[model samples]
Target chain A: MTTTTTRTSTAGAASTRRTRSSDTPFVTFEQANRRLKWALLAPALGFVGLMIAFPLVFTINLSLTDAFGAVNAGNSYVGLQNFADALTDTRRFWPAVGRTVTFTLGAVVLETVLGLALAMLMRKAFRGMEIVRTILMVPLLATPVAIGILWMLILDPTNGIANHLLGFVGIPPQEFLGSVSQSLPTLMLIDVWQWTPMMTVLLLAGLTTLPEEPEEAARVDGANAWQRFVHIILPMLRTTILTALVLRGVDALKTFDLIYATKGPGGGSDFEAETLNVYAYGLTFDYQEYGLASAVLVLFTLFIVAIVVVLRRRTERSAS
Target chain B: MTHVLRPRAARGIELSRRSFGVLAATSVLAACAGSPRTASPDAPLRVLAINHVWTQAISRYLPELEERIGRRVSLRMLTADQLTSSFNVKLNASATDIDVMTIRPLQDQMMFARNGWIADLTDRVEGDADYRWTDFQDAPRERSITAGAAVSVPVVTERPALYYRKDLLEEFGGAPRTLDDMLDIALETQRRSEGFFGFVGRGQRAGAVTQWSSFLYSFGGDFTVDGRSGIGTPEAVAAYEFYGRLLHDAGPPGATNMSLEQAMPIFAQGKAAMYVDADAIYSNFLDTSISTVTDTVGFAPFPAGQAGSVPHNIPSWSLAVNEFSLLRDDSWEFLRWASSPEMVARLQSEGIPGARQSVWDDPATLASFPADLAEAMRINAANGVGHDRPEVMQVGRARDIVGRPLVSGIVGEDVASVAADADAEFNDFLVRDNRQQEF
Candidate 1:
């Protein structure tokens, strides 16, 4: 009994000695600061895991099954059939993908150029600059669906003030929302009007955070104002530009409310305005093709992720 | 490690338990979404209705209906469009927030019935002593069949009739009796009149489809016969050609964009010399807020084509019990009391059309009607057409493919070519939606 107790005490003493020696050299300030930063980041990591990662996993699972309308007993594990079908089907899935690409590309390109102009215009501080910025934020602050409705009323073919003004020019009544050929471009214009302000605000914020020293140096080195802006300010704002593009691109791809409010389900008779998001919505609600919709959503999410990754890489390259 | 993690682990388990409790409670409460079936006589039967002329009927009958049925009743209103696109989908999937649903046969009976979202009210309708199935009109009752079962109780019936300017017809020597006479008037009126459309009709795809269907049906043409597209035939092509010519010569430029909403306003503004649509619009003209040509308007049957005279069938909303409804007993009681002959009389007193044949024959009701309403009801009672595709399953897609493009064609799209386009779409829908099986 005494021998056994002595052996156990010896083992315990050895572990304590090891722990004491490890603690003797205190952590350096830089190391502590690095550890603290990571510690601070832990909560954000946990948040992303819960909000983004968990839902993504759930969505992936939903995509692989034939879960349909009313949540009845007919949900079957259909493997990758839904994904395969979505890639091939013409009724909604493929057309929606085309619409999403067009809308995202169209909206992003226009907003980027328009937003840059607005940002540059406001960059030079003058009288009422604050007031002009405040006015520019109105479209961004307006709810999308509400703005869509407001635009609808203004663009009404018969009763609208737009036609009333057009009549003065002898251009006979034109069907705005009522015409199939014109509806998509009309919706795009409305989207641009509402979201360009948002892009402008973001780019403006980025412009404010940019260092003035590089731009001043370029000006001193015999560069004109336009040349300095093109060579110096544009390169410096690359990260911010990429970030804005990615953020706005994702939202544009998923645009639902404005189109829905304007055209309604099946996207106004011919589905002229249906984006990928709207198509998924119609599948889930109008047709109750839940499995197909889930598949479409899953693939759409992948496309969005690919875009984000490419943008992120570009941002990293620009930083370097 | 154990000492440090013990409290944290304990708290995590407690938090999980609390969250589970909340979730379980929410699930239970959400599952029990509809009203309870077995309510006391003193409690009100929660009723859902559309806000229209129907509301007038409900308001008039509720006090007497409550006393007669020995149950208190209440109502909530929604638009017909709202019921289909948004409300029904939401109500059916989750807890049925509705007990009694007011629906149109076009959407409610067909679409809702197909997905098994609606209840099998056959037993309730057939077994109930107070329902009095024999008292119901044949045309309206026949509309309830979906998948070989009756799913709705029809409230009102509508038939197409001509609303021409009495002054114009008298000035032109007579009203049109057949398709030829109608064409003659159109040609003559356009030649004589300036800045006026001789024949005003909806030319927008959705609206023009209705106009085309009437013409097609009148000429013995149809979308399907023996479960195949009835387009690409001589008679169908001839009908399409006639409609195209009529619109090209007599209808206004840019008529392709015109809809019922646009058509009504134009007709009311005296820009249209003649108009044809459902009988329901007669009341719209009477409404002080809308019409300027109410007094000058005259009524006639839709012009007869070669095979038969086509009357556009505009379906009114019907009352149907939700299958998920727990308040089946109260719902049936309310339906019976509200739809009875006596109740219909009260409704008719306020200009709400009743679905009963008896109400149609009532002398007081007949005497109370304006000449236009009386003429419309007489036509409706004698012969009113329903939808060609009455089956509840995928009829929506079928209607859109067949009807929408036809209407679009009216607005200067090639009528013959577009008719072919519509036919192809119809054939595809019939095959894909399993509509062929129904035939």
Candidate 2:
């Protein structure tokens, strides 16, 4: 009915416009409508162009130059020497790449598994559910830097609550973030603690959206709870799981604040916890190697894009 | 209804277009009409500084500065790293908002001067007689000059001092005067105390370099000798190994990760027998809230090595005018007032050390400090080197390379081989750094 009314009104408007004199100053109504649509969209398009496109293009251009120290300082174009330098750099670049991958994979995998399990357990409403939900949101609410500091205090080797608790259990004190070997793993745990709740919330929403009929039908067919979940609920939740993976994966790859706050520049003495994001930041701000930093950023951007594209493809496939 | 809606929709579009044009015009007008100049007649003299004791002590007397200059003063303080980041982002774009900046002459003066981010203060500092530019100590005063121009004026100077437990050291015949005695006392103290450490200092790769420089110098070595890498020298290797052995055997379990923020607490809490760090942080040992060994803490000159005690007497912080600032004259006025003889003496009496030699010379100012600490500071200052870290354009990267062997020592690795490797790396970095400077 709405479509019919809109069609009739448009026809009436066209007929009314046709009755006007051909020598009128205004163009046809269709042409004016088209121009008006573009004029309205121009500002938003301009903003996107300025904010996103310009910086990305500028960074790519910078990657090809020998920009150093101040941004406005005189610098000559050095072609792809910066990229070649980064690619060949085993000391910092490769180690940072390895760390970024290790951190993202370890943190995301744990978050997804734990989040899915928690979401399943909490799917049904029970006593004091709201309070439990609120408690789960605490980690998500705190700033990353604040969380990093809190974790550092808790995990301090000599005089921390974590060591105190371990001592009660007859375990020796473990250097969590302090030891170079343990820094990355400790950061992964912190990431898991802070972000698992977000994953649970997302998966819970997905769980709520799942149809109950299929599960009921499987239960009625002599399937157990685990069987019904595996046969029915899991298959249906594939798209949501993949969506959550993409969202969380992208975020995990770009983690900086917590790592920087806890481990500091070059990600501790040995650059043990220095991921790609932190490395790029150190190069750009700390060392003022803008040209080299830009090259690393461009490469990092492409790496993230490639991962996102692969994940998105899987999501679409699961949805189909 | 559709015919009526079409004209209204078109009119809405037309209104939006008109509004956009008006908004665009207003934005252009706003862009052209800049904010009131910070240097203007009645505007505040804006200062960006690090959140240090010097900045804190000076902040209380800002009203005096304002009264003298006949203008309001706006001082904003940030952590050292935060201040550096702010300067890099702001000065890169030639920001005029910051009139005066507290800078690290040794760490960032070269870069800032090279980039022309800081104004040349040679004329203002030298031409004014009462300001007494030469009154500043030789080591710190020499550091203020970048490329033959006085780019910054030293405000706070630092040197390494031995912080020992007075109570613990009495059993070992007081503070050790030599490196060997210090190590022996540290080892004996560690052997007696179950959970306590013998010696604690910075061990982090980059953060440890400045403190380690004193040891390097006393060991008859330097970061560079005649513009070449010096870390592979026998003296340098011995220095690195001795530092590593000191920490690895008698220091805490995670000494490799401890910088000032981590290591200072151990000494303050009476968990370590001997600690060496900047003299600027002596108050941390005396602060009731943070220190448990206030009464027991003792200060001594940096322990003598093969070449005797040669600590780093360097300008830790300084004040400079932003090159792009419109209030350069007013900024100069603030600098001169802050660094003047009377002001430095006043601040020094309150326990904030100043760069002026006259302040150090005054017995009245020395009265505020514990007698031993004052003596230590005096001796260290007289015998200190100008620069602590590697003197290069990329100081951060250079420190990292120079400090790799230090970390190796702390982690109980072979120091000689690591020093050789790091020495090679540092030489390569210096060559590249020199090339960049030429650019």
Candidate 3:
């Protein structure tokens, strides 16, 4: 028994000595814990910073220079000239900004409202609900370029299913993609068709997690569905709604694939559907004006961030 | 404790080292085994080709090319625009990968020559007695020089042609010989038919610039004269008006937004009576499977305007050696062989339009293609201008500037004012290009 006790004491003493040798007493357990926490997170934090900050810094640098196409071996620095040029050019940049805003707002607003309605409808259980859910996922899961081509064929003025259906109603063919005036709205509708499902899925998830007590109590108190939804359900879904808004709005702002696939380059022939993203791509690759393209991208980023900020503030106020 | 931990940690590290060594060795062996490239790095002649029809034809004769050059050749083919953009990036990096690349002689290739991006073949051509550099037809051979350097070899000279329906023309009247005559024929034809259009051409902004240039030149105007913007001239305005009036009043309803891709289908399917496009796309018209009116489709020179007919007689694509290439001698051998008279004749026999006097003038070539089409192509080739779009480093930007007004014209906006606005932009373009870039 004495030998056993002595061995336990010695082991404990060795462990204590190790602890003392590894770190000074000045660093308490809490301080060591804080250090361990930081050390654990260092790699992820560093990766995130490098991924986010590196491209941003490089883009800003390119924006400030007079970097042109591939031949810009030196890319002679002409500070802020590109920015000035892009800002003053009422012909291309300003018009592209207007288009970007219009496309984003139209797509996001419609998607959110439609998504909410869809989520509400989908909340109730029904036969083949899983199949319906899977069906809803199809558009979101489709390749964007394939979708664009499919829509192009379906909306073809002379030979398309859309026109064929219209003919049955004794209606004339509509110039959907061909007409410049109609192209933007048509593209917006396409965006809504594709992305509304994403919002529906997100809001559906939010709806599932909501507390049932308030809803039941409201039902017992003789409140109607609309009233309860407006006063309680909506209020509780603030974070979920914001999440959907930011995700959808940001994606809509950066919409390039569908538009590019539908229209060749520089938006359509007349630049009818050109957003700032498309314009920047044209500047960078088509025209080889890298410096000017970078400036446009920078300004576009600012515009997107400003929009998100404004949206967040409005949502916060409404939620409160 | 230190003594115990030391051996364990060392053993772990030693195991890791052995594993890493094995992995590295295995990877090295796999890479060597999997790589299909067998020729010595310096021996393989790297050729970059754009997927133009002419290049597609060239691809068919690669075995013959290898025999003629007496070297192993590796060809990299990319789509037209992708090749162009990638070529610029590759050249900027001074990469020695591509020994030869397909280029345009006058349009954008001159800019490469000015920047010393391509090798000058002047000495090589002048020294070779059998190469016969002068036999590539005067117009195409002359365009081969850029900044006084012979940078490229001609392959195919593409000229715009008016494709018309013989049956439709016979019913309406004889083929229209002039612009005004065409207008009358188109209007009458349109009025008489239910699903037929009088005329159709490209109307997209950028690509339209090339087709639109034929109109501008026929109306006795040009994009520039001695480095001055000529878009505001009365002749240019007249051209725009006539072009716009034809598409809006006589052509199909949606012709305003059509490119050659869309316009050709309507013509081939017998929806439109006529189409004006590059002779390079002749296959699209001649293919029995694609063209319903192939039997009735007849080729003609562009109808005369006030200045008579002028079409783009430029080489749509060319092959040039990269200046930075280590295999310049090998690339030269490929160019010399592929552009040789016998090789060209072989291709011409297969219906590839070779950019040479001998090829177009050969009896076999004329018989191989349509005889009437050959005659017209030969005449247009002899007379067409060297550059359709502005021959400058900033050609794309300049095209966009001049092209916007063309869009406005198609869409029924006041094109005169649009041209005025574009002219101002064009003038600015000239200054910017001169101030900043070289070619």
Give the range of the ten consecutive residues with the poorest summed lDDT in model 2 chain B: B1-10
Question: Clashing pairs in model 1?
Answer: B110-B392
For candidate 1, give the DockQ.
0.14
Report the C-alpha lDDT of model 2 over B1-439, residue by residue, as the tens digit: 3222233334444433466677666865886585666555866889999999999999999999888888899999999999999999999878888999999988898888889999998998999888888999888888999878899998888899899998989978899999999889888888523558899999888999999999999999999988889999999999999999999889886677788888998889888999999988999999999999999999999999999999999999999999998888889999998888999899899887888988887899888888999999999989999999988888888988999999999989999999999999988988888886663
lDDT of 3 by residue, A130-242 (tens): 99999998999998888998898787664458977987998877778778888889999999999999999999999999999999999999999999999989988878898
Tell me the docking grade of candidate 3. Answer: incorrect
Best-fitting candidate, measured by DockQ? 2
| Residue B172 local lDDT, model 2 | 81
How much is the lDDT of residue A176 in candidate 2?
84
For model 3 chain A, where is the 10-residue window of minimal lDDT?
A1-10
What are the clashing pairs of model 2? Answer: none
The TM-score of candidate 1 is 0.81
Worst 10 contiguous positions by lDDT, candidate 1 chain A: A1-10
True contacts kept of each: 0.04, 0.34, 0.20
Off by over 4 Å in 3: A1-55, A307-320, B1-44, B67-72, B114-116, B191-195, B437-439
What is the clash count for each candidate, in the order shown?
Answer: 1, 0, 0
Per-model TM-score (chain A alone) = 0.82, 0.91, 0.83
Docking class of 1: incorrect
